[model samples]
Target: MASKMTSGDLDEQFLTCPLCMLHFRDPRVLPCLHTFCRECLQEWATKQQPLECPTCRTQVSLPDQGVDGLKTNFYVNNLLDFVAVKKGAGPGVPCQVCEGGQDGDKSWCVDCAAWMCDLCTTVHRKLPGTKEHEVVPAEVLKAEKDVSKFQRKRHCHKHKNQELVFYCESCNALVCTACTVVDHRPGNDHNPVEVSGIADDKKDKLRQLLSHVDPRLKEMQDALKEFDKETMKLDSSRIESVNQATSYFQHLADLLQKREREILSQIDATYRGIGRTLESQKEAVESGFSRLASARTFCRQAVDYENEMHIVEIGEQAQRTVEGLLLERVNLKPEQDKVQFSERVSVTDFKNDVERLGVVSSTVNVDVSKCRVVTKTPVVGLECTSVLETADEEGQAVAVSREAVSACLTGPKGNTAVPTQLRAKDEGRVWEILYTPEVTGRHRLEVMVKDRDVTGSPFDVVVRSRESAVITIGSEGNEEGQLKKPLDVAIDGDGNVVVLEQVNRRVQVFDAGRGNVLKCFPIDNDGLFGTGTDSNGNLFVTSFGESYGIRKYSQEGELLATFNPEYLRHPLGVAVLQDGRMVAADKQQKSCLLLQPDGSLIREIGKGQLQDPWFIAVDQSRGLMFVTDNRAHKVVVFDLEGNLKFSFGKRGPNRGELNGPTGVTLDPAGNVIVANKADGRVQVFGPDGTYLRTVTTTRGAPHGLALTPDGYVAVACYTGHCVELYRYK
Candidate 1:
C-alpha cells in the first residue's frame, strides 16, 4: 500500500496555471515560457491576434498546424500518474469507478482523475482507449519524498481521449490533435510552437519583474513611516498652540475679575458712608422729640392737680419747663441729609468705559496697495488727510462700497480719533481720510483698505506749531561752512548739528537754526565714520579702517576719552543714550557694542546675526536699540540687555524693503527712521517694528540720520555730498 499524503505532498502546487488556478491541463508552453491549461489558453487566444503570452504579454508566432504543432510536456504526465497512484493506494480508499459497494482503490488514472480497484485497474489497462496510458507502481510513487519536481497535466475537454499538445500563435490558443485539424488548420494562417521550449524564459521574466518592484515597495513603506512622524509633530504643535491661547485668555479674565472686585468694593463703601450720615441725623431729631414730650407731660400733670397749693407749686415748675422747652431751640423740623446717589448711568456709558479697558481691537487688513500721509501742513487744531490705495490680492482696484475700507487714527495718548470724513475715490483704489487733531503732539494715522492695514500705514504725523525744515546745512566743498563727503550728521544737546566729513577727516559743528558752521576741527585720523552727541552736549565720533575706535570729545574739540575694545574692530556708527551709555555698530566684528559712560564695553549684541552692521540708534524711552545690518539688509532691534526683540526688512527695492541700510535714528514720535543707501529713501517704523511710512526720498544715498528737537530729520547724503533736512515726527 502507498504511504498517506502529508502537507509536504502539496509542494508542487505552484506548478498550477494562474489562469485556471488548477493543475496544468495538457500542459503546453508559450513563447514567453509561461505554461497554462490547454482549454484556458484556447479561450484566451480567441480574443487577440499576434498571440501575446497570458503571463507576460510577450508576442509569439505560431506554426501552421496550430496547437497540434506545440510540444507536449511528457514529464508532467509521468508526475501526475505517479501522484495519482500514491494517493489512491492509501488504506480504506474506495474505487471511484465501482458501481455499487465501496471497494479499496489499487490504482488511479491521471487523465480521468479517478481511483480504481485491482479488478478495475486490470480492466482499465485492457481497454483499447486506455491501452497506452502510463502507470507507475503505487509503492514506487510512495517511496519518493520531494514532490516539488512534479507537474500534472489534464486531458483535452473536447476530445477526452487525446491530450492537448499544441498552441496557436495567431489565436494564442492551445489545442488537441483533432482541434488542430478542424479549427486551427495550417491553411488558416495559424502559427504554433513547442510549449516546452519557452517555459524557462517566462520564469526568468517573472524574476526580473520582482526585482524592479522591490525597491519601489520599500520606498512607499518608508514614505508612510515619515508621514506618520510628521502627523504626530503637527498634532503636538496644534495642542501647544491651543494651550498657549487658553493661558493668554485666562490671564485677561483674571485681570478683569480683579478689576470688577475693586469696583464693587468702592460701591459698597460709598453706600455705607452715606447710610451712617443719615443715621446720625435721625438720632439727633429723635432726641429732640423725646425732650419735647417730657415737657408736655409735666405741663398736663400740673393742670390736672385739684389743690390750689399743689397746682401753684407744679404750675411754676411746669411754666419754667414749658418756657425753657419753647425757647430751648429744640427744632422739630430737621434739614434733610440730601445724601443720595444719582441715578445709575445708562448701559451705553458703562459699555463705553468697559470697552476702553483693554486695547482697541483694529480689524485685520490685508488688501492694501499703498498708504501715505497727504496733509501738506499738519498743524494743531487743523484738518489732516491720509490717503490709502486699496487693491485686491491680484492688484485690481476694488469697486466703490461703504465699509469696504475702515481706518482709525490713534493719538499719542492711545485714544482712537473719530474721522470727520472717510470717502472712496478713484474707483475705490484711493481713500480720502480727514480728521482734525485737538491738541499739538504726535498723532498716529492708521489707514486700512478692506480692513487690512495698507502698506506703510499708521504713519507718525507730527502736529506742531510749525511743520517744516528750519534750515539746510553743508554743500560740496572743503571750505569753512562747506562739507566734502559728509558721512554722518547728529544734533547736539545745545541745538548744534555735528557733521562728520569722511574725506576731509574733520568734525564740523554747525548752528542748527542758521546752518552756519560754528566750529571745524581736523581730526588726526582719516577714518571718521559716525558722529553723535551725548546728553551733556559732549560729542562722540567713531572711526573705522586704520583707526577702529570710538572717540569722545568735548564741544570745543578737546578729546575727552577713547574706547577701543578688542572686540570692536571697525566702529561705523555711534549713538549716546540719555544716561551716557553708548551703542556702537562694529562693522568688522559684525556686531553692536553697548558701552558704559567710561568707554568700557558692556556687551556685544547680534554677533552672528548681523552682517556688516553700519548704524546704531537708541530709544531710551522704550529701552530699545535699532541696528542697521548693511549687508544683511535688515534692521535688528534689541533690548538694553542685548537680547534680540525682533527684526524687519529684507533685501529688495520695494517699500518696507531695505538695501544697504546705513544711518538709523528715532523720530520725535518714537518711530525708527532708517536710511536706505541703495534705495535712497528714508523709511520709518513704529517702536515695535511696524512699518509706518517712507518719510522722504533723496537723490543720492542717505546715510547719517539725526532727529532735531524741532521735529526735523537731518540726513547726510554721502554721494550727494550734502546734508538734506526733512520735517519728520
Candidate 2:
C-alpha cells in the first residue's frame, strides 16, 4: 500500500501519530489544539491522571467521557481519507460489494470508503441508496488538487442517520434538524442558525483577529533578525580579538628566541677561552717535570757507577735543575676553568612581567542594568554627571569606547540639550556624562550606548538655583530665645519660624531674622515629631503618643483642626501641599502617607522599601516628594502619584554618604538639604539625588529643617534644642 504513493506525494510524518508512530486512527484534538490518536490519548491518560498536551506541555481538561469525548480532528480525517482514496485507486484493491471479494478496478466508493470491482461498481450505482454516493475513479480523485474539496458531510452523534445541518450559536455546537426541534429549540437560550450564516460571521471575526496578529508577527520576525545581527557582531569581535592576541604573543616569542641565541653564544665563547688557559698551563707543568727527571737521572748514575769527578759534576747540575724546577713557578692547579652559569638579568622579574602581560577580553556591551546617574540633582549653572558602565553577560566590567556613549537632556516642552562632555574612565568601562541645565525645572536625562537606552535611562532631573549657608540662629538654653531638644522646625508664609520642642511640648513662633520668640504656643500632645506651615501660614504639627494625628493651628496659638488618618501611625514629619493635601512620614509604619485635604488616605508611598521614614519635603514644581529614611540612611524620591523615582545616599561618614539622615527639606533652588543626625552635618543634594555639598555641620543633632523665604535654612538641633538659620540661596 505504501509503494503506490511516492515520497513526493506528501509528508507522511505529519499524518503519522507521535505516540503510536503509525497512521492516525480516530484522531482526537485536545483543548490545546494538539491532536493525537484516540487510543493513544486514552492509554496516556491512565498513566498520567492530570494529562498535559504532549507537544506543548499545557495541562489538558478533558470531557467527562475521557479521550473518546475529545473533538475529532475532521481536517486530519479528511486528509487521511484523501490519501487512502488516492492509494486505493490503484489495481489489486479488494472489492467491498462483491460476494467473492475479488480484486477491484481503479474505482472507489467515497461514502462507503471502499474499493469495488467493475461489475460491483455498476450494481452499486443502480441501487437507490448507493447511487447518490460519490463513485469516482482513482485517476479522477487523484487529479483533484484541493484537499478541502473532499470534505464529507458529518452526521449527528446522537442521531446516527441524521446529517448535522444547523449550528447553535448559544451553545456553540452543531446539530441536526431533529436536534434543532428538541435540544436546540429556536429561542434566546438555543438559537440554532443555518451553518452557512454563522460560519460567515465567525470567518469575519477570525479575519479581524488575524489583522491584529499579523503586525505582532512582523515585529517578532524583526526582533529575531536583530538577534542574528548581534550574533554576527559577536563573531566578528571574537575573530579580531584572537588576531590581536596572536600577533602580540608572536612578537614576544620572537624576542625570547632571539635572546636565547645571544645568551647561548656568550656561554660558548666564554667556555672556549677558559679551555685555552687550562691547556697552556698543563703544557708548562709537563715540561718542568721532564727537565727535573733528566737532571735526577744524571746525578744518580754518577753516584752509583760513574767516577767521583763525574758524580760531583752531575750532583751540582742535578741540584741546580731541581732548584730551578721548584722556583720556575710551573702551576699544577687548573687556571680559568670555572665557567659557571650566572644570570645577568633577574628571571623572577621577567616572569612577573610575563604574568602581567596583556589581558584577554570578550566583547563587552553596554549593560543597561549597570548604568546609573551619578548626579541625581543638578543646579542651573553647574554640571551634573551620569555614569554608564559597560559589562559582559556575566556582569564583569569591560571596556567600551567613549564614542559609543551619548547623553541628552530634555526639559519642559521637549527642549533638547546635549551633554557638555563625554569622558571615559576605568579603562573605558565607565563613561561619565556631564550636562548643565539652562533653566530651573524638571528635566529628563537619557544616557544611551549604541542608540540603546541604558538601565534607568531617561532619569528625571530637577534643577534648582544654587544655595549656601548664611547664619546661625539660636544658642543652647531654656531661656526665651533659647530652645531645649527642638525636634522640628518650619517657616510660615509670613517668614516666621515655628519650632516644635520635645521637652516642653512647646510650639514657638519666632522672628525669622533675629530668632526671637514672637508667640509661644503650648501643645497638649506629648509626642510632637514635626512642624509644617500651609500656604495660609497655618501651622500643622505631627504628633504620636496616647493618640497619633496631625494638628492644624492658627498663628495666634489656637488649634484649628485635627486629622487622624487610620493608616498614619507614629507620624514623624509632615508637609502640606498647595492643594491642601498632606504627606506624613510614619516611623512605625516605615512608609509615607499621602492624605487628602480632610486627612483621608490617598495612597502609601515606599511602603515596603523604606525603614524609619523620618521627614518629608515636597517639590511641587516638579511634582516630587522627598523622604528621609533615617535608619536606611538615604533619601527616597517619589512622584506625587506615589511612584518611586530614585533614591540616593548610603550609610557612611563620607561627603556623599548619609549617616542617619533626617529633617529633609528643599532649598530655594530645589536642592534637597538633609540633616544627618548621626554625623552632625547637613548635606545638600541636587534634585536628581546627587550629593551637592554640605550646608553646615552642627555641634548638636539636627532634626527637622526648613527653608526660610529670605534664602536662609532653619535647622532644629535636638541635642542643643535651638534653631540654627544658615544662608541657603
lDDT of 1 by residue, 1-729 (tens): 123333364447534776888777777644333456777777887878978776545576665765555544443444454465566667766777884224443654555556666777788899998866754445655666543223234456688877656655576555667877777776558865444444333333333333443443344345444434433444344345334334433444544455444433433443333333233334433443444443343233223222222232233334443444344432232222221222232333544444323211111112344234353335555565666655433443433345656777767787757465787776455777877777776777776554446677677776654333335577788898888889999887777788999888898888765577889888788588988888789888888776778888888889988888787788888888888888888877788888889878889888898888888888787788888888889999988898999999999988888888999988666788999998788988888778887877787688999887856688898988878777564
| Model 2 TM-score (2 dp) | 0.36
Candidate 2 stretches with Cα past 4 Å from truth are 1-472
State candidate 1's TM-score: 0.37
Model 2 over residues 242-268: C-alpha lDDT tens digits? 454444444456545544444445344
Top candidate by TM-score: 1
TM-scores of all predicted structures = 0.37, 0.36
| Number of the top-ranking candidate, with lDDT as the measure | 2
The worst-scoring run of ten residues by lDDT in candidate 1 lies at 357-366
lDDT of each: 0.64, 0.69
